[model samples]
Target: MRIVDRAGASTAGCILHGAVLLASLDGGRVYLLNGPAGSAIAVYRLARELSAFDFPRGLGR
Candidate 1:
């Protein structure tokens, strides 16, 4: 898949744990945790586009 729009904050870091993908941006102030399908192909397709935001510290697990 390709990125259709080139807008938004730059990605700072990314980590994959099992099926979950954690993406950090804006100097780690913002993050996006995505859990796509278990399969590789399905994950790739679902990751085409995702939104990120600052997760509340109190809400973290």
Candidate 2:
């Protein structure tokens, strides 16, 4: 999939959850979305990206 950025540049998009969610690379961040939040979750660095994906798993189930 291809997505347009704030600068109007077309970039590759990685679809998540069967197209209901999208992850894209922009500048220096990996943007995550739920498709209904009206905004995105962005990870700007390797550590931040790891932490972002890790935080959700920290809650004990």
Candidate 1 per-residue lDDT over residues 6-55, each given as its tens digit = 34433332332211222222222223344343344443333333334324
Candidate 1 minimal-lDDT segment of 10 residues: 16-25
Runs off by more than 4 Å, candidate 2: 17-61
The TM-scores, one per candidate, come to: 0.24, 0.23
- The Cα error of candidate 1 at residue 35, in Å, is 14
For candidate 1, the per-residue lDDT at 4 reads 17
Q: After superposition, how far is residue 60 of candidate 2 from its true place, in Å?
A: 17
Per candidate, the number of residue pairs that clash is 0, 0
Model 1 residue 7 CA deviation (Å) reads 24
Model 1 clash pairs are: none
- Which pairs clash inside model 2? none
